[model samples]
Target: MSGHGVALRVVACGKTFADGTRALAPVTLDVGRGETAVLLGPSGCGKTTLLRIIAGLETPDPGGRVLFGDSDVTGVPIERRNVGMVFQSYALFPNMNVADNIGYGLKVRGVGEAERKARVAALVALTGIEGLERRRIDQLSGGQRQRVALARAVAVQPSVLLLDEPLTALDAALRERLRGELNRLLRTLGITTIYVTHDQAEAMALGDRIVVMREGAIAQIGTPRAVYFAPENRFVAEFVGAANLIEAACNGATLALPGGTLPVADGALHGPATAMIRPEAIKIVPAENASLIGLVDSVSFLGDRQRVLISAAATKVITADVPNAIALAAGDRVGLSVEPAAIRLLPGDTT
Candidate 1:
């Protein structure tokens, strides 16, 4: 909290290995001051590469630049970048206790004992590791280790914070719990944070804006709601959330599907088109009043909702999420209705 977060700019940044392997295409992005931007994609999508470039751990290609506010840090090394990094492994020293680990960075910068102690104590309380000051890194639980790593990273009051899948090592429940806690901590700290994660849920929860990356290139960048509801491309639509890509022929206002006709939000000129609908958007209705009818292929009972897969509604199997109270089973004939606004027309052919 002592250091002010600066706006970060990555200008036409690209990366290529020595063997001529291009890990990332040139990407230009701006992260506003105290903004939390998440670089999200699948494995090998170069999200980590981009983060490393921003951290000054990996240099960008010629003509690419990384800037912190007005300062060009492209040529700066990680040690001189005034940034905090938390890795998937936490990377705490096995020999160091919690207090020592949190105060290590300040000590390295030649801060006196009294100041280090005060800083360490404050961070310990901030990260909720109050009673673990003397606990060794190896003696803590995975969650505790994660908290310690975070405290250590922020203790130096870095201008920027970079986290690379910091919660990937935890159990599912713990990961979910820590995500909320982390979100709160980040907002409280008001640091310019760039987080990298392959998990879309994590990205949605933490990112003020999500940068969706594909094999070395950015597919889309938008707020979680924007990307989830109006994906710019097929990859983003399918990756950010569960989307049902339906292939149908568009005739102005309605799409002619194999099962029946569905209305579109727009009634403009169109031919064959690919449309996307979220599972929760599809509502199950009485077959007599519905235009689309299908036989249920499978029903998965999730705690709060039921994932119902219906066939014959479209060219492909259409999945829907209905309230758990609604009884549904395989082989049952069901009617499906969706609001026209919920259907998004995506670019590209119906293939």
Candidate 2:
């Protein structure tokens, strides 16, 4: 249940296939000891490529280095790197029982039976698969199999843990349930962990810091709140969460749109600028006193809140989340108000 985690660093790592397709651009990242860093992005992004490089499964381009604590592990094979890996497929042994699968890593390393059994027992209890130790792989449920895979990976007491979409196989409800458990388990083990997933919710929940990648390059890297609230670009803003990308003309003090103008936090910003706003930040107000007004294009009731799409507010349609208590429907005119602080000026045009 406990193991020391080594700090990990990757310096200018890039990857190119034999067919001359570049899978990853140069990426340099550092993961603090015992910290969980999530690499998040859409498919075909360089997140997985970068992970493969760090895990020693794929070699980085010339001059790149992968370091484990103070040791240079750039050239070391995965077996010698002492890193634990859990794949999307779970990869448990069908022929082995739960206990046997958990202990397989130790047995391969020539560990004594007494020590292996002790480690396996600890992991079984840690993963909440106590009575299922003797169960075959096919006999276990999806969640149970996930825990077994996790237990087997950590059984070797690896210096670092690498997980590639570990929960993608589970149902939505089960995925969410196990996500909380995994968060707690990772913190308890204190293992320097790198997780790759396209699910922003998963990244936000598990990562101490998130590295958002796109098209073989890193788009942004920061804490979950920072990434969500202050994205560096339109891509990060839209990908991390629900965002309203507004195109307007800035005249040093306010942003001018077709409906009305909004006060800007920075008066020095002039000319065309792309503004990003979260749906929750927009408040519904009386149209007569409001600066911005738009006609409701659609409304979707979500139990606790309503998602309202409005047009004629900015250069593009905007979405706002309002309390379900507010009665709204299509074709209704509403006013929108946002605090200056809630408006983030993103670089480049929204287009």
Candidate 3:
């Protein structure tokens, strides 16, 4: 679904806390109007800091700039920025009822009682919380409380929506369910959204484009399929999914693995390189065919499939995902084969 019609831009944005910790580097990015862009990375990777800067909760460094549409908002205050934010903790007023909490912003802006009630009622209906108007904050379920928070944020019709790990406080099942619902709701509203989350699955499922960060810098940005299946670097490959990087000698059109040689696709890197392969890409067969041969060291059931860990030559541990019905045990000899097209040769020092 498309994002909101307003573009949010961050140019050369950087942040350093008062305690001398540089939380963000000089990073630049753009979130298109009505596109849900997800900032994903490990902890302390500056994703949250960047979001806070855009929200005007924290100031950017000297060379940083924040803008909405064509207006430069680098010096704008939080209240005047017209941005909606959903926090990880549902920051509802414990003393207020659901309706009052949802209509708090309108009241602060001096909206008349009749107009406030109508707006809050419409938002409650839009968020599917029709009958819980009188419920207290403590009386609602976690998911319901989150919906209230979302309704309250969007009640003002802010220009941009910023979400900071909004579903992380819920249980796994609830988180998954809410993610699907939130995706649908956001798409229906067509609001420009910047979602910050460390959960790769959530980022992949909801984002139109996933921005992978590392050490306060953008590592890679692309569609979920592009980031997962065709990573540009070893870090992106390993971070986005489980990858097996095998040291190999590339000679124009062939790569030398530990046990066998495989033909490389056109434009494959030459000389010493790392061959990146996914666990599921390697198939366990009866005989080796331009791939390695190894003995099964461990086998574990992963619900829909059985993951077999094999010990190949050169002390390499390769994992192969087979069907659950495939009967396999430790000490079994198996040959591994990977399609040439699936073999990604990356140039780097893998040591």
Candidate 4:
């Protein structure tokens, strides 16, 4: 952990609108020094609203407190909080060139011209915007403008960096390319950062710990693998990744399915149970040697792997990810094999 990076804590933080609509419920979270925490969810899930509260752009309702390391900053305003922010809109000055935009913060701080120029040059180099320093904001491409925005935010070297969908403005290819670059840059900076985005792929790519939000509340918070493979509930399972769900009455210790019974650990789950399985966990084999039989409804070649949609496997269509080399066509009867450990059982009905 970098000494310059600060840990953040929020205690019982929440918000409500003027019309009395609660945009966020009381929630608490922590981000360690030099850690990157991603707030991920759909629109209106309160991820952005929470980011605003932490950035000091919005105040929480009473009885809430925000802390940066040992300092309580709930009453602090945005500028005094020493937080750097990046947004999706590429909020750069239209008339300013890249160097001016990057050095604007240092210049505002009354730094010497020599130091300001040195800092701006370093940032321009660090962000790979070297030759574009003299280019006006309008002359830069979307990705270049985004890089400039990041450089501007980080030039101040604040304790915390808050990014709100910073890559959302680019097209899919550019977004993905910039996302990779941003991930590398963030790792190099090692600043305690909080990122907001609805894209699960971005969350998985950049987040050290993902805070999955839904309906203004946190659904689950954990490492990417933990949240995706060992979700606490059905919503977390489906939201983090594609999940194949099976509703079955547990006959003793086993779950009865379409073609055969799936053996589970003793005392694993009883009565009516829901089993969540990832598409990649199912292995395609000869129908005679597998647990379930299904007819392939469709097959999509997804470059590295093929996704085959199986009909009449469980309650819904069972999608399987197999290697592209595995020859399978639509309407072919196939057997799906799932490891006992891969099947995550959820007890009871929807709680």
lDDT of each: 0.93, 0.93, 0.86, 0.89
- After TM-score superposition, the amount by which residue 28's alpha carbon in candidate 2 deviates from its true location, in angstroms, is 0.3
Backbone clash count, each prediction separately: 0, 0, 6, 0
lDDT of 4 by residue, 88-125 (tens): 89799887889999988888888899999999999998
Clashing pairs for model 1 are: none
Error of 4 at 21 (Å): 1.3
TM-score against truth, every candidate: 0.98, 0.98, 0.93, 0.96
Q: What stretches of model 4 exceed 4 Å from their correct place? A: 1-3, 347-351
Q: Model 3: residues >4 Å from true position, as ranges?
A: 1-5, 288-290, 313-315, 349-351
- Tens digits of per-residue lDDT for model 2 on 1-351? 575789999999999999999999999999999999999999999898898998999999998999999999999999899999999999999999999999998999999999999989999999999999889899999999999999999999889999999999999999999999999999999999999999999999999999999999999999999999899999999999999998888998789989898887977788889989999999989899999999999999999999999999988999999999999989988899999989999878433
State the lDDT of candidate 3 residue by residue for 331-351, as single tens digits.
987777778788887758522
Q: What TM-score number comes out for model 4?
A: 0.96
Candidates 2 and 4, the one with greater TM-score: 2
Ranking by lDDT: 2, 1, 4, 3
State how far residue 55 of model 4 sits from its true place (Å). 0.2
The residue pairs in collision within model 2 are none
lDDT of 3: 0.86
The CA root-mean-square deviation of candidate 4, after full C-alpha superposition on the true structure, stands at 1.6
Task: In angstroms, give how far residue 200 of model 2 lies from its true place.
Answer: 0.5
Give one digit per residue, the lDDT tens place, for model 1 in 250-280. 9889999878888888788499888999999
